[model samples]
Target: MRVALLTEGGYPYLTGEARLWCDRLVRGLEQHEFDVYALSRSERQEARGRVGLPPNVTGVRTAPLWTTDDRTLHGAGPRGGRGRGARRRFLACLAELAEVVCRGTGPGPDSSDPDDMADRFRNALHGLAELARAEGGLVGALRSEAAVRTLERACRAPGAPAAVRAARVPDLLAAAGLMERALRPLSLDWYGDGALGSADLCHATAGGPAALPGLLAQHFAGVPLLVTEYGVRLRAHYLAAGEAGLGAPARALLASFHGRLAAEVYREAALITPGNTHVRRWQERCGAERAKLRTVHPGMAADRFAEIGERGYDGRADASGTLLWVGRVEPAKDLVSLLHAFAEVRAAEPGARLRIVGTAAEGREAEEYLTRCRALAARLFPGPDPADGAHDDGAVSFEEIGGPGVPDLADAYAAGAVVVLSSVVEGFPISLVEAMFCGRATVSTDVGAVVEVIGGTGLVVPPRDPGALAEACVALLRDPARRERLGAAARARALELFTVEQNVAAFRGIYLEIVSHCPVRRDALDEAGEPVPFAHPAEAHVPGRWAASASTAEAAATPSWAGRETDGRDRLKGAAV
Candidate 1:
């Protein structure tokens, strides 16, 4: 099978989210051919450069979603008087989009109404895609005064929210700039049959900008789209919107646009695989069809920690009363609560030690948080214990990870009897998973997918509550047998669900299954000009050569739930937003 793997801000880059996993996936699935389409997040990420490509990956194409590329983005405006018609169409689509974004509607992706909010959204979006494809691009038009004016008109239209109506010139500029960036995929040249459409399957590593090409491919060539989101993009956008820079109206509009876009993608996708149920619920709330949803855990290589995991068993090898917390030092990790919890643990068992092993995050927020945590730790556990006559192993020690002292990740996990996670905000807990992979019992905060990942293998406490967290830690520390059992179970669970072998096998089956199910719309020919049997889109349900009335033409191209059940087409008409 030929898969077009789409990624945003990661993959192919030597360092970024899912970089190694993507390489692993491509290498593991050697039977398939892969063409990577990556969207870079920053100049620094680009500077880090691409990773060594594996043999299975045939080609790579990338575009800058962060900084605008000079040569293409700043080209001359549309030639031969194409401007007036384009502007008029753009305004009409913008009006409908603004109406939907300003005043939300529908029950998400499961809605059965024919002319629902999604259809309106799809029509407007594809109109813009068509405009971009027809002209050289929409780069100039998207940033034009006309676009701004159109947005202004939509904001001030009747029934629009007061927040959107209050948009000033600065707010209008901000909204326009954001829209131009969000709609950048429409201006791209990858919509044709030769690019994304050529693939047997369109596999998006994430949602939002990364899935945009897949949407275009499905629209143009009736290809199936598979979207896998480890981290929810809508949540990221919601969190980012609160951070500042943009005006209130712009933020509101951007959030609405992203929310609606997510809904549209969910509605059109053949399958939606979330890394955990936490993300799955988010997708469900955002309107993803229940049937289309699947849960695929993030794949990890267990071999790195295999030896330590196997050796640290029976509560006999290198057992200590020490508790270890390992991960990047971020506010989300909630180290302050952990420090307070450690204080409680010390009150119960005076000999107990807590070692915070991690580096501070990159930026002032993390630096300040780390500083506060160190001060709190000092206040909680005053000085080195008098029992330690020679090597001063303090009650509470904060040491940066990845140095000569710790040496490696396994060393950090192996240093303590119990691994701790105190995060208030988390996706899949990589540190907790790593701890489990090291065959260590864990105490983690009940946040994000921590509970789902733990699967009764670790003790979980409500986040930000020191009493409960401390109690859980103390309970596990006293019971060595319980800890050993949990540790063994955790290691077994990690091997079963999170390993690379299982991930590759699951996807390999899915690829073959989808290929088997989808109907072949086009036939391929051999070198002798004879029609090849079972050439592409697999063997079952091939479409016959038939003419369709303009009204019902798109019924043939509608995407099904995991390509399993039939769903009617979302015919694209009206102006492009």
Candidate 2:
């Protein structure tokens, strides 16, 4: 079966967190053909370009979200991008969208009810979508003065929130621009009978525009959508509101817009797969139905860590007990609390050492934070010593083991007797997983999915508490047998749940299940290039049907091939019980 894998700011983009996972998923499932739909967030990311894709990946289509000049679609005489009727429709859609956003999304007639708000959002969204398809584009209209005026009226509308009322002209312009950028997908030529619409299933690797194409594919072609979210895109949008320096009004409206969009996506999707329970919980809280949610852990290759794990522990967790902390150096890593905890660890066990080994993340602030961490480390465990080792020269050694001297993630994990994750904010705790793969016992703060990931395989401490963190470290440090046992268990758990093989197997099953229930959308073509949609055997064309032993209720929930080939016989025959 053909899968349209969708992504935004990631996947194929060389420097994204989700890129590696997407590559693994696509490569692992070589039996299925994939067409990638990617949205780049910056020129730098676009310049970095895509990594090599598998042979099964038939094509890659990309669009920029960085900058869009309105003039490109403007300056058309009387009959330009849209005619008068289409222009009116675009304006009406924009007005309704701005209104729905300002009123907020939730339960009461007050517009806070997500269900009610979702209806309004969907209606407005489809209205704009229809205009884009019919008029050729909405870029010019979306950035026009007409769109700005519609937003102003919405902000001034009778029931508008105080924040909306407080929006000045500058704020209106900012919000309008933000909305236009967010909705740019409506004008893209990626939709229709030939593009995303032809795919058997649209699989979005992330949310937002990554899933937006899937949403459109379902809307336009009746194709089933399987949206896989490693991170909750809506929450990221909310956090990004602050990072982008958007005003309160703009941020609130944008948040509501994303919330309504996510609800509609969850409502329409055939299934929603989250990489972890932490991501799952966020989807659940965002109006995703419990019936539709599935947890699929992101896959990681375990072979690289195999060598270190094979010779792990050595029956002694007591070689001065080096405490290792690894991850991008940022304020959120809570390196401050980690330094304090290490001080306490030093007080208890004088010979105990802490080695912080990782580079700072991108940004001048991360650099500043690293400087502060170094100063704190110097004051806490002062002076460089000759006996520290070839790679080290201080009580608290800050080394870039990512270099040629001590390369490989396994080496970093093996350097420590106890792996420590001190992040105050985290997602999936990749470092903790890496440590597990290296067969090292861990002590991670209670943040993100650390507690869930540990699963009794490691000690957990509350975040931002040096005292609690210190105690956990000391307890594990003083006990070698418990540490070794936890290390072994952690490695076993990682291999079982998070390995490339297990992740591939889970998704392979999910892909088969989704395809089995839904009929393929690709139309069979004759020599004249005439459309012979569904001319292929209903069961034979159905991907994974050959080995699909069981079926889903979702299969029979809707007519498998509506508006096209399925008569009653075909529908019932395609249904697998």
Candidate 3:
């Protein structure tokens, strides 16, 4: 099958969120031809270059979302002075979109009927998409003064929401700018015959902008769309809006836009594959059909930790009292709470130690958070004396994965008797799975997908509570047999459910199932425009000579017993014979 893989800020890029997973999927399914349509987030990410793609990837086309200029916009449509008709179309579509957004999406006194609002949003979105296609792009029009005025008018309309009604000039400007960026995908020339239109299936790696092209493909052509969301983009937008410090009106407008977009994507998809049950629930709440939802867990390579898992816990004396934490050092990881909990663990078991092994996430905020965590650790547990010719062996030590102490990821997990996850917020708890692959007992807080992933294989504690975290750690550290049993069970589960082979096999089957149910309908023609016979027949997909043999073809025309009338007498005669 020919597949069009859609992604945003990932895949093919060397540094991005799901690059590794996308690479694994593409490389594993080498039989299918893949065309990658990626949307880059920034110039630096593009500058970093992409990974070495496999031979099955036929082509790569990219567009930038970071900056918009005349070159990117191509000065088409309104920017080129396409007369009053084009201008009117742009204004009408933008107004229709703004009206739906400002009125709110739910069933409230000020909102339109739910079904009416959904249809309005869908129609307005497609109208803008068509306008972008006719004109070079919508960048110039979306940034125009008229666009801002339209939004302002809608905000002040009679039945607008309270937050939207209070929008001022600056708020309207911000909302317009955001909409312009998000809607940039509508202008891409990827819906042509040689692009997405030629593919048998369009698989969106994530929601939001990544799925926009797929939506357009299904709209313009008749391509079937398969949406996979490891992280729900709408939920992420909600979390980010709170941290963005935008005004109430801008936040409300952006939220409404994303919510509506997600709903439309879900409604139009042939199938929706969420990475876990957590994401599945989010999709269902955002208007995805329960019948269309399927949960496919993320796959990880187990070969790297194979030796360690097979070795199991050897009851090493030096590592028995150690607890390990591994992952990106971000505020969400809640390393501060981990340090505090470790202090309590130290009080309970004087010989217990904690090793934090990971680098900070890519931001000044993460670096500052890492610095604060180090300071907190120092205050809680002072370093040992150096006069005795000892190394910097403190009760708490922080090291990177490739550092001298922990040279590799598997080695890092093997160095601790119990793995610790202290995140107050998490997605799939990848590190916990890594620990499971290494056959180490884990102590994780109750958060996103933790309870689901762990499945009683490890100790669970309430997040943000140092007491519960420390108590769980101490219990695991003190009991060797229980830790061994849980570690063994965790390893067994990981090998069974989260391996790369399983992930690839699941997708391989899904690809065939979707195509079989909704086969692409393309007519074949000769150079003279005459219809070609037997271009794609059912027998082509099936095995053996069912189509080639005249006798077999005739037999397949009808059931063998179709002409014979069957009754109880026939059954009795056959039995007697």
Candidate 4:
């Protein structure tokens, strides 16, 4: 079977979130062929290029979402792009989409009923799809200054929100710019018969713009779509809205657009696969059918962790009652809270020590956050001889990846009986899984997929509650056998459920199942004017059973002698007649 893997802003990108998982899926399942249709979010990402690909991947097609100028589909008097008449059709589609979006905000026929809103969204979607085909694409037109002015007029029209009405010319330009990037998929050529239409299945690695191509493929080709969401893309939009980088009105509009798009994707998909139950819940909340949802944990290579876990606890838990925190140092990690909790842990148990070891990624802001965490640590636990491997106040210690005191990640977990994750936000906590793999008991905040990943294997505390975090740490610190038991269970669970082999096996079955229900058509009609069947038993294809090898070349090859003999027989029959 052949599959079209659709992705936006990731997958082929060398270092993005979904790249590794997609690479693994394609390489692990060598029985089927794959065609990757990727949508890039930025020039830099496209410049970074793709990950190493497996041979089974037959083709890779890409379109840039970075800027409209990169696309050339919108010019009038085009040399066979699209007729100038197509502009009216494009504008009509845009008007229909804007109307639907406006209604979806609160006043549509289905505003009160989610089912009704779904129907409305579908209608507008089909309209946009028709425009995509009729107009060649929206890229050229969307990039035009005229289009931005048109959108500005709509936003400032009567009944527009107070914030939207206040949007100036620059705001309209920014909004149009954002929309051009978001709707870049409308200009893609991936919807036709030789493209996504020829694939047995369309698997989108995530939602939002990445899944838009898959949506179009299904809309035009009768292809079944499978959406695998490791992180809830819509939720990320909402979170990013809080960071103050984007204008409030732009954030509002964009979030609504993404939310509606997700709802549509979920409603149309044949199946929704979430990397964990946490994401599954988000899908469910966004109108995904319960029957259509399946939870598939993200796979990790566990062989290294297996060796460490097999070694068991390196020493008695009671003797080395240290707390370990490992991951990139960022504001979300809540290192300050971790430090406060560590102070409480020290107060409760003098033997308790906290070791934080990880480098800050993402730039100067991360560096500043790390500095704040260190300063907080020093103030809480001050010491005159800070050089002597002792905390300034004998409570908390901070180090980097290869520092003499911290060494490596696995050793950091080994240094403590308890592994802690204090992040206020997360998608999936690889650190918790890593600690589990090292057979170290965990105390983690309930964020993202923490509860689901932990699955009762470790203690989960609420985020930002230093007291609860401290209590969980102190509880585990006091009980060595309980810690060992939890650690053992965690290791067993991670090995059984989260290994690369298991994830691959789950998707291999899913691919077959999806294709078994919805197969792609590659053959044209036969001379009989009937649809040609693709696969059949060899014996069934023969007259008096002339079965050949299952090779296409052998099936189509006819011997010269056989042809000559048939012609002579036909001539003899004609003469007799």
Candidate 5:
């Protein structure tokens, strides 16, 4: 099967969400051909270059979402002056979309009738997509003053949401710019016959912008779409909106747009795969059907941690009392709570030590958070000031995973007795899984997929509760036998459900299942435009070499059943038997 793998800011890229798993999936499924359609988040990511793709990846087409260059946008005016008719059509679709975004109440009693609102939103969104396809691109018009004015008119309309109605001229302009960027997928040339149109299936690595191309592929052609969301995109948008510093109106409008888009994508997809049940709930609440939802855990490489796992619980004398926290250092990780919790652990067990191992996430905010964490650690421990050397052998030490002390991830896990996750917000707790692979006992706050991933193998505490976190850690630290038991169980669980082999196998099965049910209906043709006989043989679906003999030039041109009265029907029946 030929699969079109759609992604945003990931896969093939050196960095971005889901890049590693996507690479693993593509490389593992060597039987299928993959054509990647990537939407880059920034010029920096594009400039950094892509990871070396496997031979199975037949082609890659990328478009940037960070900026709209003239060449990418194409013609200046709507339809290059196809006349007032085209402009009117564009205005009509934009107005419908703006109105839905301004007033649509998503999946709740807040709206008078949510189903009606959803239908309107879906119709308006598709209308715009159709227009963009017909007009070559919507970039020129979406950036025009007309689009801004239409949005302003919708905001001023009666029954508009309070936040949207509060939008001023500047806010409207910002909202218009955001919409243009988000809808840039509609202007892509990927929907052509040789691109997504030819794929047996369209697999979107995530929803939101990543799935937009797949949605269009389904719209323009009859391609089936498979959506996978590790971190719910709509949820991310809501969380980041506050940090974006946008006005109330713009945030509300964008939120509505994303919600509607997610609903539509869920409605259109043949299958929706959420990384865990936690994400599955989010999708269900946002209108995904229970029948269509499937839980596919993110795959991790277990071989890297095999050495540590095989070593068993040797009870390292120096590291026995050490507690380790491994993940990106961001405010969301809530290092403050972890530090506070460790202070209590120290009070209870004077010999206990804490090791924070991970680099801070990109941006000034993450750097500030890491700095604050170090200060708090120094104050709590009352040892050598972390400002001088944070990595010193203090009660609380912060070190990067790849540094001299910790040569790699496995070493970091090996350096500690209990793994700690203090995130107030998380998605699929990857570090927890990594710790499991290394056969280390974990104490994680109950957030996101932690409980689901842990499956009672690790201690769980409520988020932001330092006392509870400390108690859990102390309990595990004081009882080595219990820690050893949990560690063994965790490793067993991780090996069974969370390895790269399992993930690849699950997707390989899903690919065949989807195509078997919704096979692409295009007919194969010869150079003279004549229909080819037995181009897609029934024997091809069978799990054997029955169709292999047809590979010869004469057999390929004229199937063996060509001379028979019943033709391919008899052969298809024979293969079924």
Candidate 6:
């Protein structure tokens, strides 16, 4: 089958969150041809270029949300006026969105309001669809100062909250910029004839703006949409908005837009695959049907770790078994609490040492947290070789992966007897999985997806509780036989469910199941001169047909529809019109 894989700031990008997993999926599912529609987040990310593309990838089209294109609308005057038909559709969508936003602003009834919200959502979506069809794109209209003025008026009008009424002109401009970016998907021209419409399925790599194009694909092309989210985009939006100093009213308005978009995506999607149960709950809360939801864990390669766990169990550290914590060194990891817990572990077992490995990936948050941890370590383990009899210098060692100090990550896991995760917040806990794969016993704090993923193989502790974390670590440290047993069990579990092989197999089956359940339909003629169905990727390339043209051009051209082409093949290429 031909699949349109939609993504935002990920996949093809050389540096972006979730890029590797997406690349793996496309490469693993080579049975199906893929067309990647990507939205890049930054100029730096676009400049860095893409990861290697596999043979299965027939096309790759990208647009930049970081910087708007210089294209301007021809019909609109300097003051930005539109024709009667354009005005009617624009107001309809805007008004419907406004009503939905108002209803969800903590005032509307819960029982009946969601249905009302759904109606409003469909109206807004259809209205935008019509506008896109009529105007060729919504870019200029959405980016207009007049659109921002309309939003500002609606936000500050009668029944507006005191918070919204207080919004300044600068705040409105910022909100307008955000909306324009959010609506970028509407301007993409990937929803026609031989583009997404030619695909057997539309698979979205993530939600939010990434999935918007998939939604359009389903809308305009009659293609089925499959949405897979490892880290729920709606949750990330809420978290980002909270941290970015967005005013309450602006946040409320923007959140409503995302909420409506998610609801629409969920409603239209044939299936929703969330990486963990934590994300599943978020999808459920956002109006996804239970029948369509599936939980698929992100697969990691575990062979290297499995071999170490099976053969190197006896080679672990002997004295005061060191506790190893590996991940980005950020405040969220709660290394301060890990330090305090190590202090307690020292009182009971004087030979204990704590080794922290992994560099911070983000801003100063990681470096600042590492600095504080070092200072705390100095106070706890005072002298050189703090484990010596001179004074209890709580032995705390810090190292970075790929650095001259620590060349290999696998070595870091093998250096210690117990793997510790003191994070107060976690998603999948890759470190714990790595420990399991390495055949090392683990003691991880109970946080997002920890208990679910560990499944009794590792000792779980309450997050933010130093006593509990210490107790769990001490128990694992004291009993070598039990640690060996748990480590072996954890290794088995990781190999079984968390391997890339398992992940690929699960998605391969899911693709077949979804396509089989809801077969693709297209209005076309067959050999008998009767109306026939279009089913497979090969079937789309029959001679004397448009699909045949696509196949021939695909072979003769640059092997992708990523750039501008004036040939007949360009007629079906996916791009912003």
Best by lDDT: 5
Please identify model 2 stretches exceeding 4 Å from their true place. Answer: 70-81, 105-114, 315-317, 385-391, 520-522, 525-577
| Candidate 4 structure quality by residue, lDDT tens digits, 367-426 | 788778767777887764322444334556666777776566666766678899999999
The residue-by-residue lDDT of candidate 6 on 51-137, one tens digit each, is 889999999888778766544222221123556656655755766566566445444434445775686666576556546654556
Q: Please, what are the lDDT tens digits per residue for candidate 1 over residues 1-577?
A: 7899988889989767878778888999998999898877777898988888988888887777665444634442343367676556656666666666665522233233534767777777776666566655565676777777778887888766777788899988877777677677776666555567678889998888889888877776667789989898889887886775787888887887898899888988888889999999999988898998989898998998998888865343335688888888988899889988988998998878887778646779888887788777767766763222211367777666665547687877877888999999999888888888999999998999999999989999999999999999999888888888999999999988998898888788877766666655456777899998756543445443322221243443332211211122122111111
Would you list the C-alpha lDDT of every candidate in the order shown?
Answer: 0.76, 0.75, 0.80, 0.72, 0.81, 0.74
Per-residue lDDT value at 153 in model 2: 91
Clashes of 5: 0
Instruction: Estimate candidate 3's RMSD in Å.
Output: 12.5
* Stronger candidate by TM-score (2 vs 6): 2
| Tens-digit lDDT track of model 3 for 1-577 | 7899999988889988788889999999999999999888888998999999999999988887777666644442365366576677778878988998887733454345778777777777777766666655677788889999999999898867787888888888888988787887876778767788888789999998999999878766667799988886788888877887888899999988998889899998889999888899889888899999988988999999999999988757235598989999998889889999988999999989888888645788988887788788878887762112122377877777676777788887877899999998888889999999988899999988888889879999999999999999999999989999999999999998888888888899888766665533576677999988765545236543322442332233222212211121100000000
Give candidate 5 misplaced runs (Cα > 4 Å).
Answer: 72-82, 105-113, 317-319, 387-392, 525-577
Whole-model lDDT, model 1: 0.76
Among all windows of ten consecutive residues in candidate 4, which has the lowest summed lDDT?
568-577
lDDT (Cα, 0-100) at 85 in candidate 3: 69
Backbone clash count, each prediction separately? 1, 6, 0, 5, 0, 4
After superposition, which runs of candidate 4 have C-alpha atoms over 4 Å from their true positions?
47-49, 71-84, 106-120, 133-136, 153-166, 316-318, 384-408, 524-577
lDDT of 5 by residue, 61-151 (tens): 8877887666543443353366666677778778878887887632344455777777666666666666655555677788788889999
lDDT of 6: 0.74
Q: Model 2 lDDT vs. the true structure?
A: 0.75
Candidate 3: list runs displaced more than 4 Å.
Answer: 72-77, 105-111, 317-319, 384-392, 524-577
Clashes of 4: 5
In model 6, which runs have C-alpha deviations exceeding 4 angstroms?
69-79, 82-84, 107-112, 157-166, 318-320, 384-394, 523-577
RMSD of each: 6.2, 7.1, 12.5, 11.4, 9.4, 7.5
TM values, all candidates: 0.88, 0.88, 0.89, 0.82, 0.90, 0.85
